[model samples]
Target: MIALHDAVGRLSAALGGSPAAKLAASALVEADALGLPRFGIAMLDEWAADAAPVPETAGAQAVSWLDCSSCFAPLAVAGTTLDLAGTARQSGIAAVFLRGVRGFGRLVPFVRHLADTGLVGIAGAEGPPFVAPHGGTRPVIGTNPFALAMGRGSERVVIDIASSSATMADIKTARMTDAPLPDGIALDGAGRPTRVAADVAALLPRGGQIGSLLGLTVELLAGVAGAGRGDAKGRGVFILAFDPAAAGEGIDWQGKLAALKSDWTDGGGYWPRGGALAAGTMLDGDFAQRLDTHLARMAGQAGC
Candidate 1:
C-alpha cells in the first residue's frame, strides 16, 4: 500500500504548486479514501489538462454560472459549491451552473461536504456522449451522473449514480485490467451487445426509460445554462443546496430522519450513507504503481 501522504506529494509535484493543483490533488486523494477509485488518482492526467486556462465566472444572488471550457472542473465545481453552501444557509436554497467543463470525478464528496454542514445537497453533470438514449442504438447522452445527500449530521443518506448502465470509468478500468465487460450494459461499434470493453461504443441507460429521461434532463439543464457559450457541447453541471434552518420552525426533519434511520437499520436494511474521507488511508499496490508511472512519465516529459 502507498502511504496517503506519499500519494499526495507525488500528485502535487506532478501538478505543480498552484492552488488548483492542490485542490485537485486533495480531491483525488479524498475520492480514493472514500473507495471511489474511478474518480481517484487514476484521473491525474485528465485533471492536469483541465486545470489550465482558468474558467470565467459570472453570477449574482441565488443563481450563478461558470464558463469552464478550459478549466479544471474539480476546482471550479468545488469553489462554486463551497460558495453556494453559504448562500443556501442564508437564503434557504442556492444553485450554480457550470458549462464547458470536463469530468470532475465523483459528486459524492461535494454533496457529502454540504450534508456535513447540515444542508441538503444535489448535484448532476452531463459528460461526453457515451450512453444511448432509450430504444436507440446510437450513443447520444453522457453518463449523466446525479448525486444527492441529506441528513442532520454524520448520519446522512448519500446517493451517487450514473444515469447510464455503466460509467466510462467502468469501461476504462475493465480495459486496463483486460477484463470482460458486463453483459447487457454496453454495445459494440455495430451496436451489438458486447462483453469486450475495447469494443464498447455505447452504454445503455440505467433502468431503461427512466435513466434515459434523467440523462435528457441533465442535457437540458446544461443546454439552458450554457446557452450563449460557443464552446458549449451540452456538457454542463449544476449543484444545489438547501438549508433546513431556513424553514423557520416547520417539521422536525432531523428527528424524523434519525427515526427513519433507526427503523430502516432495525429492519436489517443498510442505509445509503456517505463515508468520511480517510486521510490516513493507503492505496492498493497496483494502483499506486500506476500513479508512480504517471508521475515519472510526466516528469520525463517536463525535462524534454
Candidate 2:
C-alpha cells in the first residue's frame, strides 16, 4: 500500500512537478485499488515519461496571458495556478479561471487538491474531438469532463465525471484487459453497438440527449473562456475555487449537504454487488483497510 504523500512525491518528480501528472497518478493508483482497469497500471509508464520530457521553452506567465509553447509545459503551470488560486481564496473572494494551457491528463486531481485544502474546487477541460453532439453519430465533440470537490469539516467529497457516458480511455483500457464494454457506452468501427472492447471505434454519450447537453455545457465553459473548443487542436482548462467559510455559513452548509447525501443514499440503495461476499472483499475484511495497505505498498515500490 502506498501512502498518499509518498505517492504524491514520486509522481511529482516523475511528471516534472506538474499538477496534471500528480492528478493522473492519483487517479491511476486509486482506480487500481478499486479494481478498475481503465485508470490503473496501464497509465503509469506513459504518465511518468510524459512528465519528464523537456520542453523547447519554459512556460511564461502574464496578468492576462499564460503561455507554454511546448504542450507538456502546461501541466506544471496549471498546478502553480491552482496553488495560487487556493491561496488567494484564503483572503477573500476565491474564484479564478486558468486558461491558455494544454496537456492536462484529467480534471479530477486538481479539484481533489482543493478539497484537501478545506476549500471547494471545480475544473473543466476541452480537448480533442471524440464524441458527437446530440442526435449525431459523427464525432464532433470532445469527451469533456467536469470535476468537483467539496469540503465537509475534516472530510472531503470528490467527484470526477465525464460528460460522455464513457471516456475513450475507459474503452481503451477495457480492450487492454479484455473486459466487456458497458451497455450504451460505445460503437463499433462500423458505428454499430458492440460489446467487444477491441471492436470499439468511438464513444457515445452516457444518456444520449442528457449526456450530450452536459458535454456541450462543459465545452462552452472551458472552450469559450479562451480555452479551445473540444474539437480544437489544443486543449484548455478552467478552474474555479471557493471558500465556504467566506459565505459565513460553512458549517451550516456542510451539515445540510451531508444530510442530503445521507438521504439520497438511503433512498437510492447501495451499489450492485455491494453486499455480496466476494473473494477480494473476504481477503481484505474491508475496503478502507485494504486501500490503506495497498497505498503503503505502492509508496514502498516508488521508494518513497
Candidate 3:
C-alpha cells in the first residue's frame, strides 16, 4: 500500500500545475492513472503524449450546478464533481450534466468512488468526435464511453467501455510511434479504412452498426442533452446515482448477487472489469526499463 501511495504521489506531482478551470480535471486524471495496473495496463505512457494532456490555463469559468432530484444540470469547467454525489445522497437519484469540461478519460475509478460512498453509480460521457458513425463518411459522434458501478459489502463491481472499436488515446500513442493500428480501428482522412497510424483521422465504433448507435446515443444524452453542447464542445458527462437501501425495501441484494456469481463458472469474467485482481501486474523487463526512462524524463520536464 505504501508503495502504491508513493508511486501515485510521484505521478500526481508530475501531473500537477494546471490552471484553475482544469485543476480539478487534472487531479481527477492523475488519480485515475494510479489504478491502471489493476486493469492490466502496465505503462503510464499509454495515455501520455509529447506530454500528458494537463491544462495550462483555466478554460472559461468555475463550475456551478442546480438543485433538483432528477434533472439535467450543467457543470462549469472546474466545477466540483463531488457536488453530483452530494445531490444523489439527498435525492436518492440524480442525472448530472457536465459542461465546459472534457476531461473524462476512464469511468471505472470515478464511478467506483461514487459506489463506495454507498450509492449505485452509472455514467456516460462524450468528447470531441473521433469515432465516425458506421457507413458514414466523416466523424460525427465521439467515442462515447460509459460506465456502471455497484456496491456490495466491501466489494464494488465496476464496468466501463468505449463504444469505439479502439480507444482514442491508444491511437494517439500509436501515431507517436508510427506503429500500425489494429485492423478496422480507424479510417483515413478520406474516410477510407487504414491501419497506418499517421493516416488515422477518425475511429470506427465497436460492433459496426450497433456500437455506432450506442456511441451516437451517448453523444446525444451526454453531449447534447446533459451538457447542452450541441456541437459536442468540451467534455460532456451524464451521471446517475441511487441508494440501494431506498431502492429495495427488504431485498437480500448481496445474497442474490452471491448466488448469481456461484451459478456462473469460476474464473469467468469480461475484460477491463473481468480478470483476477490478485494477479500480479508486471511489464516485460525491456518495457519496464523504457518506462522508467520515460518517467524520469517526464519528471524532469515537470520540474518535480
Candidate 4:
C-alpha cells in the first residue's frame, strides 16, 4: 500500500498538483483496500501506462470559472472545492461550484476526502448525456452521479451511486470479466432489455421517474453554478461539505451512530447479498501460510 501511494504521488507530481489526479489515486487505493478487483489491482497497470500530461488552469476560488483545456478539470475543480469546504467548516455552511472543466475518471474520492476530514460531504457531477430516460428509446440525459460520504465511527461510510441503473464503466467491466450484470441496468441497441454486456446501448434510470427526478436534482446542483450544460459540450461538478457538530449540540455523534447500528444489527435483518464478510476476511490464515511458503516461487515468476 505504501508503494502504491508513492507511485500515485509521483504521478500527481507530473500533473501539477491537479486535484483530479490526486483524487483518482486515492480512489484507486481505497478500492484496493476494499478488495474490488476491477477497481483495484487491475487498474494499476492502466494508471501507469496512462501517465500522459494533463493540462490545468490557474488557481481560483471555488465559485470561479476554470479553463479545463480539454483535460479532466471537473474532477480537479471538485477536489479543490472540497478541500476548501473542509476548511470552511470552521464557519457555517460551505457551498462551492467548479465550472469550465471537462472529463472525470471517477468521482468517489472527492467525497471520501471530505468524509476523511470529519465532515459530511455530498458531490454531484454532470457529464455528457449517455443514457435515455426510462420508457424511452433514445438518449435523453447524462448518467450523472451523486456521491455522499460521512464519518462513521473510526471508519467512513461512502456511498457513490448513479441515478442510472448502471454506469458505463460497470457495463464495460462486466464485459471484460464475463460477469453477469444486475438486471434492469441496460438495453440492447434495438431498445429491448438485454443481459449481454456487449449489447448494452444505453442505460436505465434507477427507479423510473423518481430516479430521473434525482438525476435532475444533481443536474441543477451541477448546472446553475455557471458550469456548462449536461450535453456533450462540457462537464460540471458541485460539492458541499458540513461538519456534523455544526448541526447538533456538543455530543459524540459517531458513538451514538455506532450504538444505533449495533442495536439494529442485533435486532436481526435479512442477509445482504453475497453474505457479510468482515474486512480482510478473504485472506484466510491457511492462504497466508501458503503464500509465505511460495514466496520464492513468486519471486521466480516475477523474474520470468
Best candidate, TM-score-wise? 1
lDDT value, candidate 1, whole model: 0.76
Better of 1 and 4 by lDDT: 1
Look at candidate 3 and give me any clashing residue pairs. 63-79, 101-235, 102-235
Report the lDDT tens digits of candidate 1 across residue range 86-171.
Answer: 88887789888888776577787788778878899998887778899888887986887888999845457998777898877789
lDDT per residue for candidate 3 within 238-292, as digits (tens), equals: 7677677675757866666566555553568532341112223333454345445
Q: Which stretches of candidate 4 lie over 4 Å from their true place?
A: 16-24, 28-75, 152-155, 170-183, 188-192, 195-200, 224-226, 231-233, 248-252, 267-304
RMSD of 4: 7.8
RMSD of 1: 4.2
Cα lDDT of candidate 3 equals 0.57
Worst 10 residues of 1 by lDDT: 226-235
Question: Candidates sorted by TM-score, descending order?
Answer: 1, 3, 4, 2
- In each prediction, how many residue pairs overlap at the backbone (N, C-alpha, C within less than 3 A)? 0, 12, 3, 0
Pairs clashing within candidate 4: none
Residue-wise lDDT of candidate 2 within 121-204, one digit each (tens)?
A: 777776677777666666666788877877644334666667777777777778799989878777776777778988876678
Q: What is the lDDT of residue 144 in candidate 2?
A: 80
TM-score of model 1 relative to the true fold?
Answer: 0.78
Local distance difference test values of all predictions, in order: 0.76, 0.57, 0.57, 0.60
The per-residue C-alpha lDDT of model 2 at residue 151 equals 62
Report the C-alpha lDDT of model 4 over 59-131, residue by residue, as the tens digit: 4233334444344452355456555564547664565655555554455666666776777778787767767
Q: How accurate is candidate 2 locally (lDDT)?
A: 0.57
